[model samples]
Target: MNSLTIALDVMGGDKGPHITINAAILAINKEPRLHLFLCGDKSIITKYLLEHHIREHPQLTIIPTTETVAMDEKPSSALRNKRDSSMRKALDLVEQGKAQACVSAGNTGALFAMAYCVLKTLPGVERPALISALPTHKENKNVFMLDLGANVFCEANILYQFGLMGSVIAEQVDGITKPRVALLNMGEEDIKGSDHIKLAATKLSANKYINYVGFIEGNDIFTNKTDVIVCDGFVGNVALKTCEGVAQLVYRKLDRFLSEHFFARIIGKMLAPALKKLFKSMNPDQYNGASLIGLRGIVVKSHGNASAKAFEAAIFEAIKEVEQQVPEKITIALEQGLIEETHTE
Candidate 1:
């Protein structure tokens, strides 16, 4: 098997090196082909590795960084001031070809800024978008959503590009042939939504390479009705956070109701195993990583408050993208789509 190198911004997340170091250890152990460069303060990372007794493991390497990007740091501040930060160095590794991909649970804005500044976008990509898979209604099936807070707003052309990007992810990463693509809007009607959205829809529908399914409302996101859902960062971010909130509410309400009475508690105990499995499927932690697509290199962003297991999932997410050559695929798709558009015009 071919070995893969990934860089982790150990000091960028909420729990700092504590969570990322453990996740690195977990990833290296589970995937023998993985070699991780832990980018952060050497002293802190050394302490964690010592605690785990794998300080000198061949699969692990430390890339000492003097600074760390704070969770609340502004994008401009981080980009201009934190050059040697753990987050910046991790991205640098990818840019330098020392690592095929990088994963971080850091400031979203800062990471995006550093990544864009460092790796730049593929030839035809204007801006990168955050994308990740979500569990759908069908068993063992998932749907991909894009623009999860990568940009505040996008024009019609950008949104049209997002649909193309999302379709490639669904087809190449998820192995869905000619995946159905939809625009997330207020209504499914052709005349609804802003003019840009309508324009994007018209462009998508006309693309023979894309299987455009028209617009879908928020309620249908998890219904497996569409393989790819494209929207601006504002709406996608809100929809993602809303799903997380609703999942937590459901678990809390179910647990409280089950423990309210003696008979109910007994029933809960009886259903504990199944209930645990159900909640596990719904947990946002399992889906912690969101890939920033359209860049020259691969980057997977973990949730800020991700636990060790959650962050480990992010590392593996990067690994998958590396193996899949996602950036190359996106470039080809965009280039082909652009040529087609030019001919039509």
Candidate 2:
């Protein structure tokens, strides 16, 4: 594989540089071909590096910055005033071709704003969307969902574009051929959703490149019925949070039940490994990285409260995206979809 270089916003997340610096070291140790440009305060980053005994590692480069984007910073304020912040500088590296991708666990709005302003959207993409993979019911399978709180609402054409982008990620990143794509809606019936959704469905169905699977309700998200599910940020974000909430609830309830009875406790002990494995597959931390798709350059958003292991997963996600040439593929896919639509007309 070719060597990959990625820029890291070391001081961008809730945990600050400590978590990010540790993740950077973990990534460097795991992937020999990966190099990182750590953008943050020189003193803090250096201290962490020295403690790890990799201050002079060949795969790491420190890009000093004096400013940091706070977790509560307004998107507009960060964009206008944080030109020299770690988040901004990391994005600049991608814009200048110094890095293949940028990864940050920063304020989502601020990251989105800075990345949009710096990298711009790919040609034919009006708005970029957030895409992430969620575990499916089928063992070892996952489905890609998009527009996870990037834009509250979307026009018909924008939603259609999101479906196309999601399809590209599913196909290219997951190696799924002609991945089935669907829209998240209240019901599966053609007449169930708002006008924009129906119109978006029509557009997706017309595009030969996308295997449009019609509408799917939220309950079917993890059923592996479709490879990609598309929706506006508002709906997608709510669905994602609900899934997280339910997962936690189920785990806690199961634990409580097993502890209430001595016999159940014995059974739980015997079933411990299997239950642990099942829960691990459903752990959100393992899927911490969410890709901001439809942009000219690769940008991954790590969970704001991610641990070192979770942040390392985000780094690996960036590496996979870079190796797959996701942005370039999405561009070509959109162009092809447009041509196919024109001919259908």
TM-score of each: 0.96, 0.96
Model 1: per-residue Cα lDDT over 1-345, one tens digit each: 438999999997788889999999998889999999999999999999999986598898899999989999999999999999999999999999999999999999999999999999998888899988888889878889989899999998889899999999999998999999999999989889999999999898888778999999999998999999999999998998888788779878988999998899999898889776666655443456899999999999998888899999999889989999999999999988888777766
lDDT of each: 0.90, 0.91
What is the Cα-based lDDT of residue 289 in candidate 1? 85
Pick the lDDT winner. Answer: 2
Position 236, candidate 1: lDDT: 91
Writing each residue's lDDT as its tens digit, candidate 2 over 159-189 gives 9999999999999998999999999999999
Runs with alpha carbons beyond 4 Å of true place in candidate 2: 270-277, 280-286
As a TM-score, model 2 comes out at 0.96
